[model samples]
Target: MKKLHHIYIISAFLLSSCSPKISSLITKDYQSLKYDEKVVVLGLNEQQPANAEVLGVVKVRDTGFSTKCNYEIALDKAKLEARKVGGNTIKITRHKKPDLWSTCHRLDATILKI
Candidate 1:
């Protein structure tokens, strides 16, 4: 019974390690931009460009099962969402680093068109 319990725990760990990250976006009508256009990333305290137009909000997070939830991966996911909504820049609003409960980076960002 003890060995069976260990096997179950190992199986659960393996399943979680293979899970994919999740992302969400909320936006209005905006023309999608070309992939060739570079998407700029802004820090939490960074000031947005004066001529920038707000496009939408983006969030990337670990679903408790996500494995490769690193900062770069999360940021890239947010940028992809921004590009889909015609945003040329992303302003990071909240960043949650890996903690005891989750071994993944999470972020909330505001998409903008400059």
Candidate 2:
């Protein structure tokens, strides 16, 4: 029974550690909102939403977790932050590469709404 418990605990830890996560740091302020499925991620030079308004900016942080985290995770986190800041769209404007192990990443983006 003790061996079984140990195995279970280790398994749980391993599983959790395998998942990727990213966080948002507010660079601008706006009315708080709940991110919706309608939110869109605009291209670097997407021209369609030229008239879209800027809500704010956010700095996305991700500690490139043990090969578990990827670029997509960081980008998604930035988009989510944009949505929460009362925007419907997100456009990453800058990127900071991580160290040799990719243990840290920073993404700067503009939050916009149509």
RMSD of each predicted structure: 5.7, 4.9
lDDT values of the candidates? 0.83, 0.67
Residue 97 Cα positional deviation in candidate 2, in Å, after optimal superposition: 4.8
Residue 16 lDDT in candidate 2? 63
TM-score of 1: 0.77
Candidate 1, residue 71: lDDT: 91
Model 2 / residue 94 / CA error / Å: 1.2
* Pairs with steric clashes in candidate 2: none
Measured by C-alpha RMSD in angstroms, how accurate is candidate 1?
5.7
lDDT of 2 by residue, 1-114 (tens): 999999999988777665444445555556656755566776556554668777767775543344544567667777777767777778777776666656655677778877
- Which candidate tops TM-score? 1
